[model samples]
Target: MHETKMKPTINITRLQSTFDVSSSIGTTEKGGLTRLALTKEDVKIRDVFVEWLEEAGLAVKIDDLGNIYGRREGKKKEAGAVMIGSHLDTLPKGGRFDGILGVLSSLEVIRTLNDLNIETDRPIEIVNFTNEEGERFTPPMQGSGVITGNYDKEIIYKLKDKDGISFEQSLIDSGYLGDIKNRSSNVDYFIETHIEQGPFLEENQKDIGIVQGVKGTKRHRVQIKGKSSHSAFPNSHRKEALLAASEIVLTIDEVAKQFEDLSTSIGVFDVTPSVESITTEFVEFTFDARHIDNAIKDQAIRLIKEKINEVSIKRKVEIDFEETWDANGTYFSKEIMKSIEEAVESNGYSHQYITAPALHDAKFMTDITKTAMIFCPSKDGLSHCEEEYTSIEDIEKVTNVLLRTVISLANQN
Candidate 1:
């Protein structure tokens, strides 16, 4: 009988230093980063990641959507690589650890391979997906979405930032346009190390989270149209879009309360006839709903639509629902989930299998290949803000788990 061999372990200090280096790319006064997509911060951070990749002695490449890949060779050259990483882009005034942790942790993995001189049967690739924050762009996970054929290059070429700069222009500006390969199919398994971005682990007294599933999301641009009127003439005879919008917002809140696992919020809205003296003729608002179960998510969205119609009827307004983006729920493979569980146990760290309420690039990659995620706890359950954080000790714990899992996956046939 053949015996299973062990792989080399990663260095904790090196991983911590990698985290420091990336965090330094777009450092803000508030102890966070502001590396919005396609901005100068993005270029600076991409260059930093590329430099580290080269320093680790790995061959680095950039994809069409500006996704970065750093590869370390293995014993079997033809075998598919084991890819692990997250995004490098950050939201406006975002935390330091959210997406950066996964990228830096993967870098640490490659650095460990270089230090130990240990080669596996399959290569390992560290990926830094572009514009995962969706802050500058419309939908988040733009790079992964395009790579997985969710959207076409023409659409990518059309996407522009607030400054009216096209995404294609940004790609060219960043010097990333090249004949990049479709490395998605080349990956046999994918792993992401991330901060939990929630309080589940901390509340449960755990150090890490073995992600069981990621929530599917539906984003809607709901428009409530009503006749504009004078502010002093507050009567049923006069139609007001603001009132209709207020009622619809309340209805959305009510719809959210109907489910245990469902979540709903309005992130952005715009009103026409913008003045204190007059009522608005049109009101446009956004609806963001997420759920682990498809059935519940669908029902919740349906109920929101029903309420929107109700408000429109009561206020004599016209309502229209425009879908911005609706992505299906995603699940990680059992083998990879088990690897995370075992890694946590082997390291004596307490963990739990939790559902990710926030969406990620991993959700999009599920269509291309098997995906799994590891999470460290966020302090105060904060994310997408400058206050979002995970302690360095906690970061190291999750990176160690990621290292073990990646080494094991790289050795698989």
Candidate 2:
């Protein structure tokens, strides 16, 4: 066993200060943040993180994907690290806490350990993944995916944003294009802290949420083609793509309602040549569906496809579906979950084990090591918006639990 000083209490003041500094970057008119990955604002926040990590005496390393890792050496240096962290990017006009909280909380954990002069049997790592929101870049979780081998480095680098700026170029512009190679290294365990992003914890009157697993997500791009015609033309000859697209949307909603546990959303819908006097010639929309159960999620997709086909034939319009991304629901390690439960109970905080409806970087980390997540309550269960909020009191409680959990993992053989 490694010798150590007494355990230190969580410093809420420092935690709040960290959040305030990061949130100030890219501040929007509505008081939200817009720190898209690799943007100038994001680079500023990354610098802040680096400064803090160095101040705490951790050796920082950056991989080719721009994923930042801060390592605190343990007594047994050869043992795999116990990793904890989340992404630092945010959606446009996004709330202050979504991904930011996780990164800062992990840093706080390390700072507390430093204060106590504690060293454990295994090294501890705090990571900040890049491009988690995917708002600026398609397909979120790029950094974690690259490190886990879920995506090819070349493909990710070549990906472009709306302005035709390649991902690789953006990294270079931000001065974060490190020469370090990306590799899926060994990790004894992983934990990510995040806002519930839903109303579960607040509704249940719980202080903390021990996430059991995340829901499976499937995204599709649907395009419907039809002939443009004058509005005065007879309805008998017109192939109305917009009308068919609306029907498809309604059908998806109706089919999704059949399963009480399923969650479905259509976030994008567009009609080309949208004029009052002309029939829409082309329609494109995006479909997103998620469910905790694999069978149910797959069934929902099949039903949606069947409905789309039927609607296409009836409306005499050509419709095509292209799947953009698919990730099956993943459960965490049972042993790691037990440790979290013990930590929560020992910390005297009310808690519940629940499934996460939103996808997170932890989903990808699961491929490499034992992974779990801790969720703090969001006021009104809202996220991805400027109004998103979690009280400092709740944050402090969850951070304490996180600190205890990490310490417990670090000391284990």
Q: Which candidate number would show the highest lDDT if scored against the true structure?
A: 2
Q: lDDT values of the candidates?
A: 0.83, 0.89
lDDT of 1 by residue, 1-413 (tens): 11135534577777777777777878888888999886888898888778888888888887788888888877888898888999988987788888888998888877776776667888888888888988898777888888888878788778888889999898899887644573445888888889888888988989989888898888899887789777888586878888898988988888889898788889888999898989889989898899888888999888888888788788898888998878777778889998888778877889888888888888877788888899889888999888888888898788878877877788887
Off by over 4 Å in 1: 1-9, 182-184, 234-236
lDDT of 2 at 212: 90
Candidate 2 total steric clashes? 0
Q: After aligning candidate 1 to the native by TM-score, how far in Å is the CA of 216 from where it should be?
A: 1.1
The residue-by-residue lDDT of candidate 2 on 308-370, one tens digit each, is: 999889989999999988899999888888888888888778999988998999998999899
Query: Model 1 misses residue 314 by how many Å?
Result: 1.8
Off by over 4 Å in 2: 1-8, 181-184, 230-238
Sequence-dependent TM-score of model 2: 0.94
- Residue 388 lDDT, candidate 2, scale 0-100: 91
